[model samples]
Target: MAKLGIPAAPPRGRRIQETITQLRQRILAGEWPVGSRIPTEPQLVEALGVGRNTVREAVRALAHAGVLECRQGSGTYVISTDELAPVVARRLTDDRMAEVIEVRRAFEVEAARLAARRRTPADLAALDDALAAREAAWRGGRVAEFVEADAALHTAVVAAAHNGMLAELYASIGAAMRRTVTQAMGGALTPDRHVDHARLVAAIRAGDPDLAAREAAAFLEPDPGA
Candidate 1:
């Protein structure tokens, strides 16, 4: 028998999952931008029309997944837009630098080849700008800035590939890739030993897939002796 004017509650597990989905949708919709504090418990409960426990569990789940951060007395904040990025960051440990290099080489080579085939005039312009900025940054003798510029140059190459999925995958591991570059530099950006991207950009410009791929692979090959 049901009480008058009362609705039966959904199963707790289902309620929690539903709440999580609602929260994620709001996030992906950009209602709650990254670095902005999400609604408090009472607000979430009221807005989501769910129980407090359900909201708590959903928040906990996202926090564990690295999509949300909680600071005492501050509140929960969005740390990342992509859920998988944090997972990749956690897995790409310091000792796996070799594996990181290998992965990067594979990604860069394929991206170069695809960019050669698909790049438009706008893509070439972007690549030129990115390469110029990278060179200037390296020549300026700042290791951190050079690393950022290098990442930007490679990202431009991937964008020229015109493959949405590849771009998304590249973005997911972007932070990890930056860390790999920083560690590989060993606290110095040597002038003579810098990885020149001129040939890679030129090959892409020339529409030579083989040359582009080779150019990409040249800098990223892992030492067999290691």
Candidate 2:
């Protein structure tokens, strides 16, 4: 078993690990930006000098890690550049309902405060439109429409903050946030709910950060003992 000046081949597992590391390095280095489609499987195989199986496994690992997302009838795309994206994705999948609601509350309250300080006329107009849609859905007894409008209003508030990172984070958990909104609404269309929404919008429009934060917290507060 002796061949002078010859190196031993790396183990299969080690080779896969190396491949994964290389791919991750490329992705994190901005060779692939978030939301951009990655190289096709064959291209990756050729470029990485790895077997198709190895390339597929590396891609799957990155996808499960939330750095990439595979769309049906389309190629894989980078979903996030953050190394923490996988952790956040896992937590969102595993966190309890109350925990999810708490996270959303924190983000929304801060977003409201920032929106009050940063919103422009266009932002205010969008918020007003969202509010109007919500009220219309409520009065018309359209439960699904009401839930959608409620979520849109909150999204508008966050967009008004003009913080790209915050907006991206909020968007990442959008589905969970929508579910939380629907649950919080509980199929009710009360006048008090409309009043609370109006007050929150007014606070933001007036550029009162403290009042806006308070109003947002109160608006999103969960029912006691729910």
TM-score of each: 0.65, 0.59
Residue 147 in model 1: lDDT:
80
**Candidate 2 lDDT, tens digit per residue, 1-226?**
4379687767767778888898878877878755446899999989999889888888888777677767554468666666565566567754466777777889889999999999999999999998998788788876667776776788789889988677657655655665666666677766555544898899999999999999989855775887
Deviating ranges (above 4 Å) for candidate 1: 1-82
> Which ten-residue region of model 1 has the weakest summed lDDT?
164-173
Q: How does candidate 1 fare on TM-score?
A: 0.65
Query: Which pairs in model 2 have colliding backbones?
Result: none
The lDDT, on a scale of 0 to 1, for candidate 2 is 0.77
Clashes of each: 0, 0
lDDT of 2 at 53: 84
RMSD of 2: 8.3
- Output the lDDT of residue 88, model 2: 67
Off by over 4 Å in 2: 1-90, 93-95, 187-195, 222-226
